[model samples]
Target: MMFDKVIAAVDKKLERFDPIWQAENGVGGQRDRYYDKTGVAKWREWRGVKDTMVDYGAWLKNLASMAMMVASAPIPCLKGFWEYRWMGSYLGTFMFIDRLFEGFRGYELVTAHKCMHAIVRSLTKKIAFCLSNDRRLGGGKDTDRIVPMDEVLPPLFMMGFKELVPFPLQTLPEFIICDVDQHIEPYYIDVAESFGLPADVCSRCAAETGVALDDAFPLIGKAMISTNMPCNASEATSMFQRRRIGMPDFPVTLAMIHNEPGAHPYSTQMLKDAIAFVEKEYGVKYDWDNLFKYAKLMNEQNTIELEKWDYFKTPYSALCGIAETLYRLYAWASVNGTDPYFNKVDRQVIKIMRKAYEEKKEPFGGRTRHRAFLWGPSAVYYTDFPTWIQNCWGINIVLNMDSTMGHNMINTEDPDEAIKDLALFSEKATMRHHAVGGWDNVNAIWEWAKNFNCDMVLMNDNIACKGMLGVHALMEEQARDLGFHFIFIEHDLEDCRTVSRQDMRNCVNGYMSVVLGEEPLDPTLVEFDDSDAY
Candidate 1:
């Protein structure tokens, strides 16, 4: 009971300081904005709902959310206190952390599940990526087959499997968006280095290579599905793993379009064969009717997405586009195809935007000075850049490559036809649409920008994806040719060491000030200092 005089003295001093913050107008509490008696009851109601969830993990998630919500209550009343005005950034960080760790506590994580096929580690990276991410991004219930760039995967479900996972990778959008890859991947990269992986190989691939080489990713799923899209990192992983890590052999079904005449049919047959492979291997039965069910749902989602994209095209939101763009990339192609979440969110989005469209309102609320579109991969490494731009110098990213909803409509008139249609539809997903070389290759970028009324092109060069890097100059020239300014920054979508976050900010700020002729709020970021340490 004998407390030190020093403690007593500090406690008295602390109470005096605390009163200032707790003085009704202080940062001590924001309960007035978030809760009245009714609101408190509402929170309890949600707490009760969470109590009914079958999974214990829901409890942890709910508690975390509750903490975040409470922590954010002051945000609405931020103007009441100058010190609390930057609540958006703090709340944003919490949301980012929550999104990053969504499924880790729920199911036997996608990375931990067991699979029974010979996965070319190259192809399986997409599989592994989607499996781990499907639950969080798409609201997808299960992972049945790994389908790349196809809205037509209900066929596999029809065969008997519960869920079919789709890979929309040209760049790993999910991992990049999560940015937690930076935490888990560095160790894996070290493992790859120890295993004698090449230095010049893209860090994205190299990091995934680290995952396989260390046997860190749990081998799960019935079979591996991939397309012949030249993802060098995946190839490097597969080729190198064969020489080293000795991953369990699994059957790989490579879905490709060798002939334009029979391409649809070929994709359909390949998918059907893949269904057979999984049924034979995983012992899961496929339900043919699910094909039509998912097909209808996906079609509905596509329409909603188009409507949402129309809202995006308008200047309405003051939000930094990068974080929003990342979520859209996850939601639009991947999750929208899987569940009703996207449609529900789209309805809310449309509601908010309808007023804007009708009133002829600017989405950025006059904050946007530059209307930009992202090229190549996004800067997942410095995801805050978009927000920084918004806070520092109001730039609106009107469109992200992943957010493009072009040509995703699939015919559900016939499920069999839907199979081919959706399979091919998925083939045209974000990175795949442009990454797969042909007439539309780089030209597609121009075509998309022409529609969006973009003011400038912000290319986030993921140094890891060299294929796109090879044509960097051509795309930049095209952007200029379109009479729009082009600014390219060399930054990885995943790894941070290549270009530190502040430097990435500096590069973007420099471009904004110099090339775009916009004054930056933090002009210090516009300078280039090569001597700076990563």
Candidate 2:
């Protein structure tokens, strides 16, 4: 009782330091809650009594998910922790969840937590299964049943092999962990460079190469399916992976410059060949019935997703910022219509979004001053940039480059027609469709911005990406010609050590304060050191 009373008094004192409270009382500093140079908050954010309970409940759910993962495979989980460097970084998952939705409340908070918990539950199960079956950890029965593939390759078609698991090899070791802990990727990036791989290559590719060289990727599959996708940089990384993995491998090189009508046939045939290779290696049949079932689920998710976009154009969208983007990135890329749970989540989210729109309930209590269309791959380390912008400045990111991936509907009845439809969809995967598909695809940002009714563009400039380097001048000139406020936030993709989080924040701070001549809604967030933050 005494402890609770003390905490309440401290929280009340801290409330006066909050900008909203300061506006009324005229006392205290908001940034006092944190120790200098670190993200360790001295106290939890006080969001009144009700919202704090809701936030705490969601945090507990995530903790339970992690506990269940370890309980399901205790020995293997322990072995994984001992064997893998990346396992230690997953401890920051709770902190990552807390930081991502820092200022959120009400329906937006509920929606964000629901979407995030689904990801957490799914990823935890995946980690447990991968660790149990990992040959490096004394291979369980399902080891041969796992089919390791490039993380960028859409796993929807792999559902046709009913008996096998389609595992994204790099996700466990490198991709997802980088988002949780910024410090994790640099070690791998350094490993790649020290191995005589050039330092100028894309950090994403370099990190994967480093993972391969360090032998961190789990040995879980009979054969590996590699791809020349997202970009040419991945081709070399895939090669390094194949060599280190030492498995029978199939190269699925889909068409680049894929906007033309002629590209579908080539990409479609490649998908077929990939299927044939898998069948031959695994001694499994391509079950058309199985693939069709997932296709219908995929179709439903895409249909609902399109409906959600209509609400995004209005002021009443309950889902905006990082909650919308991060969920879509994982659901569309990682789950890809194969999981029934995501389809369920999609249906539930859309219903909430529709009700919010009908009631005219706006996100962030309608504080949005500008609607921006975010283009290019976002910095994985600073994944909550969208959330920070809306809290500090009133910029609502209506859409991100990754969220716009692969929405085409798949035909369920016919095999021949379905593969072709899938080709059209797969070609649009993440960076493959927009960043490197061609100049026409790259230039189509104007049309997208217009459709979404965005007044500004916050373009990500990943310094090491060779493909996007040449388009800077053209994009800047076009932004001016089209009469839009534009800013380039620069970072080295996954490597936070190179650009640092503060540098990225200053990009917006300078633009908002100097260029637009605007003051921050929360001055506490305008400039703080999260350089030591997880």
Mind giving the per-residue lDDT tens digits that candidate 2 earns over 328-438? Answer: 888988899888998888888998999999899988777789999888464833557888888778898888888888999998999999999998898888688668878
Show where candidate 1 strays beyond 4 Å. 1-160, 163-178, 226-230, 238-263, 317-320, 332-336, 376-378, 405-407, 522-534
What TM-score would each prediction reach against the true structure?
0.65, 0.95
lDDT of each: 0.47, 0.86
Minimum summed lDDT over a 10-residue window in model 1 is located at 110-119
lDDT (tens digit, per residue) of candidate 1 on 1-534: 344566556555554233122322344321222232211111211111122232234334434544543454333223312221112222233233322222121111111111000011122233334434332222222343443332212222332245554443322322432242333445556678787876667665676667556543332333444333335455555555444434222222234332244555655676667667656655666665666666666667667657756766667532225544655555544454455544554455555556556766664235467777766453542344554455356566666776653345666556576667655664455455555434355566766766777777777776767667677778767876778777777776555666665566677767766766766543322332322111
Q: Lowest summed-lDDT stretch of 10 residues in model 2?
A: 23-32
Candidate 2 has a TM-score of 0.95
Whole-model alpha-carbon lDDT for candidate 2:
0.86
- Please report the candidate that would top lDDT against the real structure: 2
RMSD of each: 14.2, 3.3
